[model samples]
Target: MSDTSLLSSLLNLITTATCNLQSELKGAGLPEPWIDNASLHPWDEETPSKKYWDARRTLISALGMMTAVVQNPREKIICDDLGYHHSAALNFIVNTHMADVLAAPNVDERIGLPVSEIARRTGTHPAKTERVLRFLCMYHTFQETSPGVFANNKVSECLKKGHPTAELPLMWADVGFRSATAFSATLRDPQTAHSMRIEDAPFGAVFGNHTSKSTSESESIPKSEPGTASPVRATIFEFLSRPESEVYRSAFAKTMVTLDIMNGALGYHDLPWDRWDKEGAVFVEAGASTGHLSNDVLSVVKHAKFINQDLPEVCLQGEKFFAENNAEAIRSGRVKFQPNDFFTEQPVKGAAIYILSNILHDWPDNEALKILKHIGDAMIPTSRLLVMEIVIVPSLSQSRSPPSAPVDQNPNDAPWPLPKDYGIVNRYPHHQSMEMINTFNGLDRTLDEYVALFQQSELELVEVHRIRKLVSIMEVKKKA
Candidate 1:
């Protein structure tokens, strides 16, 4: 189809998807998302009907692709590729706590706050604050009620302190933005480009000072197998584990909590936790950070004894978290926090279920294979391993779209064909894979790669429970 025809078809798709999404929300009795007076809602809070959310996601994907399709070639190449400007603006807004300023109780939410007042409260120059806020407002992050005055929209409210996702902006603006600056350079450098070691990653190149002392010592740590060196180096976790890195570490932890709120809790929802409803059945959460996943499991799977394991510092934090949030579970001995390194042999043996949630993607194949092996060594005949992670799917490229066909030829299909990278199903996993690469020379794996890793540990892929978009619960068992 001609560019004009394609653009018209995309516009039609956007219109149709928007109408469907609105109808779904109305049917479900949920408020329509409005930029002017948006409210921040947690994922689990008054969860919308599945149909409504599915329509919402479809609408977003259609709108995004439509915008991409309509952009002129030069505009797409020049504007879409730019990032430094966005990073700088986001860094300014996050660092200055502009969202917090707008969310202040003293300020009238309806009237909003002027840039001068926000700048005064944040100790920033008014002009610079106005410029950045305006940029963000254009993208619907915040709302400009009138010229120079801004209010917190749903997106901006997420940046407020203590919100589940508040630290996300800060984490991305500080660590991710800085690391991304060196991404091209890291890829071009011969020594770093081909290396799977974390120290060779873009984050390591930019934030080298944060490297942990233990990482150097780990060079002497024996490899899991002979004739192969462990793909070990000072990873992002090591950097954050340092005493001086407490602030960044806290932000990172909160970021993980945000992810748990969004995707991790879904693990509890459509699974057969009832299978282990019998008393004394053990459930181990390996590499548990702050025990969020364990908490989710304990909330529903009452009969199981929970073991939340992580590194020394994370376990200490997890203990405090459980003490404060899940006091009864701790008091009753139903839940316990253990300091354990996953690289070492599993200390907890023969658990009914071992959950490795969002863990293996932090390492290369060699190290990931070793982690699986360690878990396998600890498993009994009936023990199961549940790996909760994204299974990256191969996406179709837009360049490979079928030859000029009439838009009406496929009435069964939407007026505009869904792009190869349509929806969060494809976008999120791909972005996360790139994030893994930037931070630790790791990657989100495809189903084939996961199956291969399972085989290397003498385990077989038993089942795959797709618990959420972009994430799946890959069940594995010892090979017969």
Candidate 2:
């Protein structure tokens, strides 16, 4: 079809989908998600509404597809493909505390602030601040209320100090950005390219304590002992565990909380928590950082004993977290924090439910298998394992033939297919997978891979509950 015809067809499809979504939202008595001031906030604060979020996802997908078709291919590829510039700008804003400046109690939210004021408060150059703010404003993160005066919008508000998600961007823009730079090198280095060892990954190569060496020399160097203090031998987690890395460790923990928020309380939505016979049931939260997931469970699934396990330092923090947030549960002997390494053994045995949220994805298969084996050893015949993680969908091959035109569809139908594996829906996860490989030599597995992992532990995969676009709850049990 002609370019103009294709554009028209896409526009029609977007319009129809958007109208239908709006109607559904109205019927459900939810607020309209306006494009100008969209509230993509988590729905966990209220009752979990799958229908509402599903509608929102549909609208977002359609809008994304429409945007792709509307942009000039050359400009789009150049601007969108090279995202480091945007990341750098955002990193600058985060590191300099520009968002905190705008959010100060004395600052007028309506009047906004000029570049001079923002730069002064942030200790940045006025001209550079203007350029960065203008770029961010274009992306709808910050807004220019008047010429040269910027204020926080919903998007920028996320960066305000003490926000639940504030530390997430910093994690990405700092360590994530640095690790990404070494991605190309990781791919090209024969010694490291295909290696699943954490020390061989780009993140290790960049931040690791090892001395600079050529690929050949690196081969001769003895592998650093796990949990050792050697500068050259420490894994990402080990490095972060050091006394000097306390700032980064705190940020990383907060980032996990942000991830949970982003997933819209997936565990609660996907798992049948209400139906679970909670009377005297033990819920073991393995690798529970700050006890956020355990807190979620305590809020919903009452009368259950909770064990929050992690490394010693993390368990200490989790204790404080539960003390501050769920003091009643701790006071009543329903909740306890235990410091136990997953790699060592299953300290809590035969729990009714063991939750491994975002844990296995941080390790390679070899390490992941070891962790699984420990969990399996702890499981009773009736115990269920809830492995919450992203299930990556394979991408279409470039060599595959172009999608054929619909045989008998209305002309107003979407010009492009709306398959779940379409580029727009899959891109974020794909990027995440790459980051996993780069940072930890880990992976976001497909369903089959997850099943295989469970099978290795002599467990049976009962079901997979999709919680969101990038996450799922793979339910497993001891093999009958």
Candidate 3:
């Protein structure tokens, strides 16, 4: 396409998408969202219809495309290089609880709070806080009402401590930023490069406390075998358990909640709970942390018994959580907690449905295969395994292979000029894919990569259900 043609196409897409979005919002009686608006977007309260989602995808894609086309490549590269400052600023704001002070009961959203008062309330250096806030203001997050005063805008409201996504920034800014700084080192290191061990990931370079294994011990270990004693080391979770890491641990918990929120409630609602809620039905959740996912599933599958499995410590927490919040389910034996390692042999066999929600993506293919194999081994002819995680779309690929099992309508399809993966709409998943590499030497898999894993594990890819923008439910079973 010619330059003018490309620009015109992008402009047309933006205009059309924006119009559709406005129409959908008006039809739903939602206030049009603006960056300055302090109120939550309607989508936060209710899942958007397909029309709204499609419009959003197209709008974001076209805007990103237009920016890429217009911006000077050299400046764009420089901007990308300085992106760490974005993380640094976000870290400072979140750590100092500046958003909390800005959104305080006494604070005026319009007049705003002075930088000095914000620093005083949050125990931060006033000058440094102002500089950070100013940097963020350039990006239209928190707004500067006056020279030295800042206030909560719609974008910044999510940074408030009580907000659903508050911890998301800290998760990336503090932990993710530190880990990513060692990315090049991990790739360049002769010993760590080409290694799939979790301890060899970029995060290990930054915060590794694992004891070095001896040559004899390392040689005895089988390649990609997870439970073996070679390269004995603590994973990120173990590191978070330290007393000094309590703040990070708390942030990590809230970050998980943020992720669940981002995945949207519709993903859970669209599952075939009614079909799975039959008499004598069993649902096993592998690597289930504190039964949050089991709680979600149990809400719909009332008659189905649940076995939530994780490490022993996590199971203890799950027990307490269920006792306090779901006493009836616990008493009636509708929900049960079992301490089990997913890397080990399968314990709960012949389950009606086995769910590995957000689990396999934490490991590389070799490790992920082991996880699938265990579930495959335990599955009966009628069993269904749901691997629910981000199923990444290939940007350059043109193939739109039809799914095997039932599928809900998806709004991810992009037209000409837009990449097959929908460009900017897939940014989060790509970012997450990178995070998996930095944190666990893992990755978010493409659909093809997932199929390869399933085939190797003697499991068949039954179908895919794109439940949310970044999440999919891939149904699988033992190869027939």
Ranking 2 against 3 by TM-score, winner: 3
Query: What do the candidate models score in CA lDDT, each in turn?
Result: 0.74, 0.73, 0.78
Q: List the residue pairs that clash in candidate 2.
A: 209-231, 209-232, 210-232
Model 1: residues with Cα > 4 Å off, grouped in runs:
1-16, 41-47, 210-233, 397-416, 420-425
* Deviation from truth (RMSD, Å), model 1: 6.2
Query: What TM-scores do the predictions have?
Result: 0.87, 0.86, 0.87
- Candidate 1, after superposition: displacement of residue 93 in Å? 1.8
Minimal lDDT window, size 10, model 2: 211-220
lDDT of 2 by residue, 112-198 (tens): 789899988877899988999999888888888888898876687777777767776566766677667677877777767677888
Off by more than 4 A, model 3: 1-4, 210-233, 319-333, 397-412
Q: Residues 40-130, candidate 3: write the lDDT tens digits.
A: 6878545687888888888998899789989999999999999999987887777677878887888778778988988889877899889
Winner on lDDT between 1 and 2 is 1
Best by TM-score: 3
Comparing 1 and 3 on lDDT, the stronger one = 3
Across 91-186, the per-residue lDDT of candidate 1 in tens digits comes to 667667778888788988876898899989998899988988898888898889999999988787777767767676566766776678778887
